[model samples]
Target: MTVFDDGERPRGGGPWPIWGIPLVLSLCGLVMIASLSLRNSMTGGSPYAQIVKQCVFFLSGLVLMFACAFSSLRRFRRWSGLLWFIALLLLVGTLIPGLGVRVGGARRWLDLRLMRFQPLEFLLLAVPLFLADRLDRSRREGFQGFLRPTLMVTLLSILPLLFQPNLGGTILVTLICLMMHVENRGWRYPLMGGAFMVVLFVSLVMIEPYRMRRFLAFWDPWSDPMNKGFQIIQGLVAFCNGRLFGVGIGKGLQEDEYLPAAQTDYIFPAIGEEFGLAGTLFLLSLYAVWTIRAYRIYRRCSNPFLSVLTLGLTMSIIGPMFINIGGVTKLMPLTGIPLPFVSAGGSAMLFMWAKVGILMRINKISLGEGRREREPEGC
Candidate 1:
């Protein structure tokens, strides 16, 4: 497929599934969290605390979404550098003496007095905006022209995440940057790039013993059932418990007692336990629809910056979705990234909305471009 597959905007399409699917998924998250919160309350773990916090996050996420949607894409392009720089600082801050919060032995969060924030999530949006702005044809284009900036951004971004020991984010961000820079020129480049990516992943796994163990555990979780495999095993049990139609919304056994990250990393399995195969399939379909629609926006986009930005933004969501689901389902080692709109992560929710907002802006601009193109036909 050529870089930006611009074509006649799909028929019967005005405001498409891009926005609607996330709203549905976000609502599902809220309902699921509320259910989990109720169970926590029953166990005397502070009633509705999870829901209350998530409610605040959900509202704040909407604000971030609208702010991005209404703002000028030009401004984002202009400010992409500053935003990325600030993100870099925050990411580095996560490693500072007292500034960083240690969770699961990884310093990936900042425990501000009010709440915790993951700078990594912000980087997901910032890196794309930066790359789209810097790599646009207006400044420079083509493989040789864009290679330096792409490598620089990838190295700078990936290093801190690696130190944070966030292999998943590192891989996702690195690949997204690589994916954005590929030109339509012939097979040699992509083939080489693909080989490079494989080497990079293998190297990354080899460098970290924990990562290697996880990789091996992915192939046979039974080998390390108590340690590396526990989360996936629990997640699988949730799927088993869910079976077909699930045990009912609030009645799930996994989220209440067994499942490891029922509201975040393993939320997919929790969804399985409560919603069943039918519900899980429906949710998967929503994600599929969301992915297809985002690409549709990318394809129709006329501007070069917006075009690359659309692909990058689409990756920000879909990449995490695949990584998280893969880990939970034992398709791959769990990287501990939250599911897109369905995870109960505050930083994740805010950034997820930000991505959707940017796409909405692009969709609006593309539609306008389409309308303007059609106006001359009437004359």
Candidate 2:
């Protein structure tokens, strides 16, 4: 089970610290979604609908999570090719007429009878597994060898992602690829990759008038307060009402209609409005702890494949989180991505938990091996 080094392995984490963050966050999300749902009932829809559906997503995601956690890594690796093919098919499927469901002028989903499925979210899981398999196999192939798989994986995912007109997803998938390369090669690749991504970002923004407008809105939302800047302005206002101590849960006005997408995209702002800055900071801190602990697992893993897999998964979680936070706070342009474990979205919730499951599986393997090695030495 030696991955690469002969150094002492760090012990596996206990359930409390590692598991607590997501549980607390998920509970908080459900509560917030439930409270938000109250207003929908007033509008004639069932109040319980959102909460019930969210519960279904959580249960389904847990099933997916356990399935992933229990599966052998070899199985996932073996399925990597199939995962990539499925990812591509789903991505393209979302772009076809009558097949892909269009929302807000962007085609990025398939209308499954039970629930809409977003293929971009699936890429978060599939692309990394694909790269880790490729990169691990290319270990001795030099940079030339590594470069081929990295480029192949990146191009395959990125092209279809952009066609969906999901700027956020395009950026995210690119970052995930860069992150894996950074783990294998060094930080320099990200610098190079960042420059390339920057060019891609700017070109896409410039080509689309809405993106350009949104980009401008990020810098100065007040210039057109009632139109392009409304969401940002409302979100900031929600935070201001929250102050240090929140206005109190279900007491905040933002979710009532002040902030557009208060449920999915701007859930953090709603949280800040109701629970205050303390609540927002608490959520961010949870993510920080999760990231640190997950990274620690990555560092401790001996198998090169598992280590790369660990790093990729960790990056995937944090990237959307910070992006969503930054967008709401106006530090960057809003990308319409839901906050991880906090946003009310079936596809995101499903995959986010699934990623956690895989990481747990890796953690189990790492710790079990450590225990077996230590047992013979009578330590």
Candidate 3:
């Protein structure tokens, strides 16, 4: 088997091989968010509010991405544990009465005065890093040897998310963890863990009447079209209205109070409504190419930690896109997962950009330029 060595440059001797795809996606997101948010902003608010905020986030994310791309992976690994702990603290803090602001009935964001953010966003990167570190240490012990500790850590991290009732975040994190575990420990451990997760997920849904209603709504939304099913119905209508070519950017009707979360969870439908099916496909293709490129870099990585990190980060970005799109199209229950790079959320955008940066760093390392770098002596 061929192994990539430290300090050796990849066959392609440049810094940004697959950055264009994400850049296009991000730009598309900004355009779509601007269009979709117009209606909401017109109602006693500045029309430019959402777009401006997203732009600020986009610029900030760019800075973070570049920092991550050029920073030391070893330094990242060293601080992974502390980051995970801080993430947990924030998650817990979000549940506190004064600290966590309630929106639409869910307490998922910390009130930072200047802005609120979901702590779970940090986990999108932290959990994977923490797991990479743990799994790398236990690579010699086999899956069975590390299974218990893995489960314990996963449960600890996910339990708070469950309390926040962030079904989407919980599901995303669980899936990412499972994928990472399977990659390092093989299929057996995750298969068992997956089964347990299924049972737990079902139980959580069953225990909550609202969740059960959401599940039922997914199966036959027409049953409660005026109430619980309104969002899905509007989403379907948006897609149907944009059958081939989109109605045209800024021309879609559903976003004007007809579709809920038109700028966030259901933004994909907004894109479909305005840009049409062709546009949606174009966006999906971008995602597909971006994910494929990330996987290619992963395949070329010789570092076990980098490989695991890449896989987890790729899934974290792509998984939510699929889930959000599926939910909007009624292919799956609405999980309230924002469409990764496309959604109007600062925290998600920031971390996602950071993940992209990490991928770029890994790509550079794989090429051999950063091969001589090693983890800190004590890390």
Off by over 4 Å in 3: 1-17, 139-143, 372-379
* Model 1 RMSD, rounded to 1 decimal: 3.7
> In what order do the candidates fall by TM-score, top score first?
3, 2, 1
True-structure RMSD, every candidate: 3.7, 3.7, 3.2
Estimate, for each residue in 1-379, the C-alpha lDDT of model 3 and write its tens digit.
Answer: 1222245433543445466777788899999988877776667788788999999998999999999988988889889999999999999998999999988788899999888888988988899888888877774555554465467668888999999889888888888888887776667777888898989899999999999999999989999999989889999999999989988988898557788888889889889999899999999998887876776787776667778888888888989998898898888889878888788889999998999898888887777767567644322
Q: Lowest-lDDT window of 10 residues in candidate 1?
A: 370-379
**lDDT for residue 5 in candidate 2, whole number 0-100:** 33
At residue 266, give the lDDT of candidate 2: 94
User: TM per model?
Assistant: 0.91, 0.93, 0.93
Best by TM-score: 3
Better of 1 and 2 by lDDT: 2
Error of 1 at 5 (Å): 2.3
The per-model lDDT (C-alpha) reads 0.81, 0.83, 0.83
Candidate 2 residue 29 Cα shift, in angstroms, is: 0.2
Compared with the true structure, model 2 gives a TM-score of 0.93
